[model samples]
Target: MRCRASARVDVSEACNLLCVDETQSEHRFEEALLRSLHQGVGRKPRFFAVGAAEESFDERWLLQVLTVAQQGDMASVEFLVRSRVNKTMQRSIRFLIRGAVGRFGGRFTL
Candidate 1:
């Protein structure tokens, strides 16, 4: 899902996304599509934040955090916090962490 700064994505064109699943060799990306809401990868995100002054925001890590949050993976969230992540970005994920804890009943530390 990484994109170069100079690259632009067009929604009208055919999808070129590749998805992988452990249970199957190939998985259709549409399986996770929010058809009713007409929301998917091509759409722009609702929020954007600047990372710590010393470090740039890592979109890949943010995506991973979001995925694990949806799955209620508190351990993974903690592990990511303990990794080489910046303090500001770590703070930014608190809302996601809070939502996961509220739903899954687990504590989070950063």
Candidate 2:
């Protein structure tokens, strides 16, 4: 009986269905986040700047990584953490250099 039931299931089709479900769930979450942000203080200049930066940011990818982490995907979490750390370090270095040049009355070059 189990063999008969298993034979009726197409593995590829099942995988496709699961993928669709996951994609829909992610889409819903993204919409909800956007709605909440809009309803909140997303229109103010400060918040708008943050939102603009974040729109260019990979929030979706971060969300996926976080979800995977919650599911115990340690490797994905580690990679994401390392990537974030590197980005933060680079931004900090740039900010410090810019500040130093500004303090010395020198033009900061990228």
Using TM-score as the measure, which candidate wins? Answer: 1
lDDT of each residue in 9-92, candidate 1, tens digit only:
332221324222233211122211111011122233332344533432444554566567556777887786556434544432
The most accurate candidate by lDDT is 1
Each model's TM-score, in the order given? 0.32, 0.27
Name the lDDT of candidate 2: 0.34
The deviation in Å at residue 47 for candidate 1 is 12
Off by over 4 Å in 1: 1-57, 86-92, 100-110
- CA shift of 13, model 2, Å: 48
Q: What is the TM-score (0 to 1) of candidate 1? A: 0.32
Clashing pairs in 2: none
Residue pairs clashing in model 1 are none
Model 1 / residue 5 / CA error / Å: 15
State how far residue 11 of model 1 sits from its true place (Å).
34
Off by over 4 Å in 2: 1-55, 87-110
